[model samples]
Target: MSKRLLARVAALTTGAALAAGAVVAVASPALAAPLGTVNLSQTSGLVTDSPMFASAVTSAPCPTGFGEESALRIGPAETGPFTNLTPSLGGGGYDKAPVTANPNRSFQLALGSAPANGRWWVVVECFSLLEGRHPDRFVTEIVVAGNQWRVPVVEATTTSLAVSPASPVEAGTPVTLTATVAPSGAAGTVEFLRGTNSLGTAAVSGGTATLTTSTIPAGSWSLTARFTPADPGSFGASTSAAASLVVNGPAGGVSKVETITADVDPGAFTLDVAQPPAVELLGGQVGGTATGALKQATITDLRGTNAGWDVTGQLTDFTGAGNIPAGNLTWTPSAAKASGSGAVSAGTPANLGDTRTLCSSAAGSSAGTFTCDAGLSLSIPDSVPPGAYTATLTLTLV
Candidate 1:
């Protein structure tokens, strides 16, 4: 070591095992590491305020057989009346006033109790392998009143929240949220949330609270439940873990139906007819044939009787130079513009000799209107001389 480094100060060397079972230590060092602060977990089995934590680590060498012990003095300073916190060594080593080292050298210590009300000092002394105690090693002070910690705080009851009906609920479906308080019998209210929006609140009962809702819209939601105790001092407020909620929309292509109805009133069933063009008598001298069309006839059945109907036509002989028989006119009947559930058929070509069928509606079908038309072929017989002819055709519907 140089003289410049000599004026310096603290020197530390790593401890190494010596051949004689003893360990070599640093020459000297400045600065001491603090001991652990008072640590408190849940209430403990031991009745004292100690043993849970070790002092902040110290640089002092803790070789084999080295240990630390604690004691309390009744005064505001180091000179106060003292009491041994750890028992003394036994047998031939009884000559020592106080001992800290255990055979295993575990320096763990505890303050069993604050027996009296007064300012107290917690003194920890390190021990050498020779049963020697160094009181100057570690020291801390405390002011005790009634053997109780000053400004004591009470632990509050905790609560947990949960949701029901699982996730992936359909929109407009009911979802239930529940909150349960720990240790039971806690009085509080629970508020439900989806993201930052509030769903509603429910009053707590029997250590639990619930909320059910059915109006949530369709979407993904980060849902959670929160609890607020009615007596804040007795119960702690807590939020539940986020619950995943996926609300689905209505299924695709859904359809709704409505019924339609109509009423039918009793009405008259009637027929209508349009006049046909007159037939021109061509080749009058030889009594040639005349072509004409029968009038269009329509039948309307406003009465929903579902009964069928048909129309027939008959023609009288002409009373001109010589009368033509009704059989001279052959007709071809056709049904047109017919509307109904029933079927309509055209009558076959036949002479209007005696009320030949023109057209007919299917049986048990009708309830609508239909029109019947026909082409008339009047064949003038060669035996009859035709100067001028006139005839009457009668149509009847039944």
Candidate 2:
């Protein structure tokens, strides 16, 4: 997350790389190179009157926003008597026009009324909404002998890689490498490499693959990503151009006089509970209750662990001249200080006769200081003999 400009550069570079590996940057001036040859999808000889199928390959997509339509037609001569294969023949047209989008387009036609012993041309015509009709382009030739044959061609693919932290980084710094494959949806795995050695292979997802590593030594590295397609007949293999990285050695060029002399303790989960001020019944009553503010209690977690803790409190029977039951004390706990605004929480109200949680934190959440306080209530049964009773409230953290 350095400069936004650098992120954009990486993205744009990836797009250009996948268009033609690294060659796209300096390739032919023709920004639009959509015309490619037409061929059958199979090597088997075309059957007479039966459906004959083929796919045309295009080097690039159609001119943008033109609604350009590509029609596949067949004929005996390259010049005349061609029929568009639109249900009038064997009834088929491109799956997705190789001319309009990708290289995996198909068309079918029948040789029902023609003499079976001659050559036929599988032609592609490009007609746009406003641009009208373009020229016919063909690559592979076909022959016939009671069965017409068309050549089958596979689509070619390109791969591009991007690396980050574009600037020189310290040795052992984690670096991210991403590979983008074009025509957008080629299925394969990308192998990330440094020089000739591979760092690892990552499965392509959404036409892109990624790998992260932090084990590089100090030096300059030429990194690349090689794309190995799952179906070679449908798409071809490709490798991205090498991107460069420079890693500096460990910190140096400074002298140390001497090491300091201080012993360091790992850490501790320390808890401090303050004694509460005296609680007094404002008026004499039978089976009555008194409420007071509980003192603040602090808990700090420095153990560097993924554990949680709870602080509970219980009370001893009140005793002065006479005794009162500890069960008469109840508290509503609150966190005066929440370490992460979430890690620690106040506990529910409970009488102190039995230990009850006052404050607590979940595992992996107890990493900072937290302070807790509560409202205290003292309820005495009418039968209890009381005279200035006192009790101890024990708080424990674990």
- Highest-TM-score candidate: 2
Q: Can you write out model 2's per-residue Cα lDDT over 198-261, one digit (the tens) per residue?
A: 8999999999999999987778889999999986756899999989999887897343467679
- How well is each residue in 299-391 modelled by candidate 1, as lDDT tens digits? 787677777887776667655556778786666567764665656677755676777888888668767778876655555577865244566
Candidate lDDT values, in order: 0.53, 0.59
lDDT of 1 at 224: 77
Off by over 4 Å in 2: 1-264, 275-284, 320-322, 336-342
TM-score of each: 0.34, 0.35
lDDT score at residue 111, model 1, on the 0-100 scale: 32
Clashing pairs in 2: none
Please give the RMSD to the true structure for each candidate, in Å.
53.6, 30.1
TM-score of 1: 0.34
Q: Which has the greatest lDDT? A: 2
